[model samples]
Target: MYEADQPGHGLDAIVAQRTPRGGAAQHGISKKYAMHHRSGPSLWLWHMRRGDFDAAWTVSDVVLEARRGTACPHLPRHEQWVWDGTPLAGRRVLVRCYHGLGDTLQFIRYAPLVKAVAREVIVWAQPKLIPLLRTVRGIDRLMPLHDGAPDAEYDVDVELMELPHVFRTTLRDLPREVPYIHAKPLAAFTSPIKRRYGRLHVGIAWRSGDWDARRSIPFALMARIAEIPGIVLHILQFGSGLEELPDGFGVLHDVSDISKMAAVVRALDLVVTVDSMPAHLAGALGTPVWTLLHMEPDWRWMAGREDSPWYPTMRLFRQERQGEWGPVVERVSVELIRLLSREAPQCASGRSGD
Candidate 1:
């Protein structure tokens, strides 16, 4: 029933079907509606991603209260029940993130907003985010929820991404503040990068995880981006994309940690990546990032837009046709040349000194 692709189906239909004869008034406050609905929160996210803010807010509150052994069984079982909108004056709140690195990076911007009310905000995050998210402000404490890691104590718990719905955020109200998470360029790589290649200093990350083949491009196609004149290309790939490069090509640095990777990113003139965490990281660091996207793109990038609201420094390169990367790469190459020609090259802001 909740299939997103189903014809004539929408959030309003679910709300209407679920609401009793008295409408939202009857079903809203009713324990029956609150307890029994299983797919409400997922539906909320579906609408939220589609930019239907009004429809998404309907289930925001109830879905969060979901827990094991209750009538609500929405989210995975957390040791402690989440207390939504609870004033955290002197409370130690646990901001546990369950999604992938990209999701965590995107939503962790709300940490400062959460800090305004909470006395102490402890971020319980995956190992990958620890190196980066550790730099986020308003976090009183940070802990890694790595494999075999033990649980800790807190007054309340929350899924980090859901903070947007809790705060009633709209497209206009999004926090576009750069450097929400901070990392410095490690001199170890920076010194070598500068001494060797001092052109435009472009970084390329052409792949995402293996789950989505559509989001990734052939490395051979990505190498074509290096053909741009007077611009030094650095491969910012992780495991799979790493390989021996052709001579006179970009250097693939040995970066095992996020902090080290971020530092390298900060040192670059620009980062060209797919829709992934590195793009989010570059945007977070206030770096000039040009992100290539798929035809049916992620909701965060929005539609028919070259710029993103979440990251002011980001310029999007989208696929004109589905299952194609040639057009996207061509446009990116043109933009790279244009950016390199500038006396004082810039993305959004001219903070190019870093």
Candidate 2:
């Protein structure tokens, strides 16, 4: 047992609060199965949430060793378990992305590292992401993931999420370098932002995917942010909640294309977003980002922390109370005002005698 994985590392409190006995039943999962699996991946998540990467990696080692020789499960490609703890050196490796877009964007940083050891690295990813990913290094081939079978052949396969375990990544070893995913500003997407000069151009995305409703902030609440002076707000949210956007809240944008969204994010001075794809995109591009989170966020944001080790440019604002976003919004507004105030003097000096 690693020192971080030992009893005093906050696991007891996390498991007790996060995984009550009946919690699985509330999600339509069997209590028996959930209990059985809780000690493995679930434990890993708890450790990760506490920023105990050493413990999480310890759990991962147990998992990989236990299931090393098992055959791939009979299930859909996205649900299928690949990567049976095989070493990647000198082999053609297929890295399948069987998770959300944000997950892929975060973990794909490992590709270049993987390529350092493997003979060839082929990324089977979401079709929409292939264009943006072309900007990344160490990929010999990029293929779209689909319902049909993949045409590329490989000696071994691994899930994108498993790369951290493969590398025995620690908090210190976790990738913090940015612009790993790069793109130029698309004129169509960035025209509104470029037109507004000498103002803080801030982009916002308040909605997350439907898997967790707690992650999404009410768009109407964003009016407080829009009221801040000397800052131009651009709405980078795409998908279901656009109708909730109050009139003239910000410049509405078509962020349906991931690559174009990257370009627009690159053009912005700062990005303020919920825990969504846009947040990952901004962080990946080396753009300064402020991520708002609910009381208990995903493991990536971790607990009791205001900064992310994964992306150095990212700052986190977390809720003190569950489902209460007013305080969080107020703090963000206050900080934005302070940011603008600091930059105002610099702007005035540059415009002097004009």
Candidate 3:
């Protein structure tokens, strides 16, 4: 088993204190599962209360099993568990996820899969994700998580990350295809951006600070790509980076709403982004995208592949070496230039081409 010295005694105490009504025997499984750190104590408590010890224990076993296999390195071993032996048939199931659009996008792929097995599948997502996740397949309803607990009740509830393993996913078994999220057009607003940059809009996102600094591309590299002619780069970054556009880069600053951003992405000719939400959004919209990836990227991107199974229109550009954004950026730049150059004739003739 992938046993590491239990690092947080405080957290262990928290789990012990929150032990469900099943008493210490069941709590023992909770404690062992908690050692995996795939979820929080509250989630464990929620599972125990629902009598999902079998599901919870399955999560624990899967983590231990994976750690002993070769796939352990690429897998997010810290983020999975088996379902307690509960038959999901006829049960109302709700899926939960913490914040982070990339994570939601990755796991939401399984929502439809889950719905296939369960009578109902309600996705409880962070508020920020609700707008986007509402469009995903297999979700009967979108429930916003509040106060770290599911706002709605269900017969069985599982964390969103746990769905893949519950379904026994391997690279070969993954649900790979694009446009899984079917978001409806809310309302159209005339973009001053269109007037300013003349058709052929492209969105750019370069950083996600919380996901490890190494996954982020340098601002300088993004600036170079923005300098490419004939393509308009709209900035879709959240928080401080929205105001941190590098010199000579044209960014649409007025986009504050995610729905509007989704519209803008849909209207774009292409999207070039780091491994972030914009990439997932673009994929969901069936928009053509070129995603920049770090060498040791999240498992959804998998390893050593130029195409993503989840998004048909999305292409990937990976770092041949770790922490090297320059090569990836340069390759993207060249590819963009070539793509545009090839399409220049089509543009001259007033025709659209890929």
Which candidate wins on TM-score? 2
Model 1 — TM-score against the truth?
A: 0.78
Prediction 2 global C-alpha lDDT? 0.75
Q: For residues 180-238, what per-residue lDDT tens digits would candidate 3 score against the true structure?
A: 76554333422454343333456788876543676677677887876777877777777
lDDT agreement with native, every candidate: 0.68, 0.75, 0.62
lDDT of 1: 0.68
Q: Candidate 2, residue 242: CA error in Å?
A: 0.5
Point to the candidate with the largest lDDT: 2
TM-scores for every candidate against the unseen true structure? 0.78, 0.84, 0.70
Q: In model 3, what lDDT does residue 245 have?
A: 72
Q: Write the per-residue lDDT of candidate 1 for residues 1-354, one digit (tens) a residue.
A: 110012212223323333333433434454644453555435654676677676666564443332222332442222223445565567777887655666677789988888987767888887766878777888888888754433767776676755775577887788888878787677676676666443677788877766566778888888897777676788788766666456656876765677778888888878999976789888989888999999876556766778988899999988988989998888888877776667332432223433
Worst ten-residue run, lDDT, model 3?
Answer: 1-10
Error of 3 at 78 (Å): 9.2
Angstrom error of the Cα, residue 11, model 1: value is: 15
Query: Considering summed lDDT, which 10 consecutive residues are worst modelled in model 2?
Result: 1-10
RMSD of each: 6.6, 8.0, 9.8
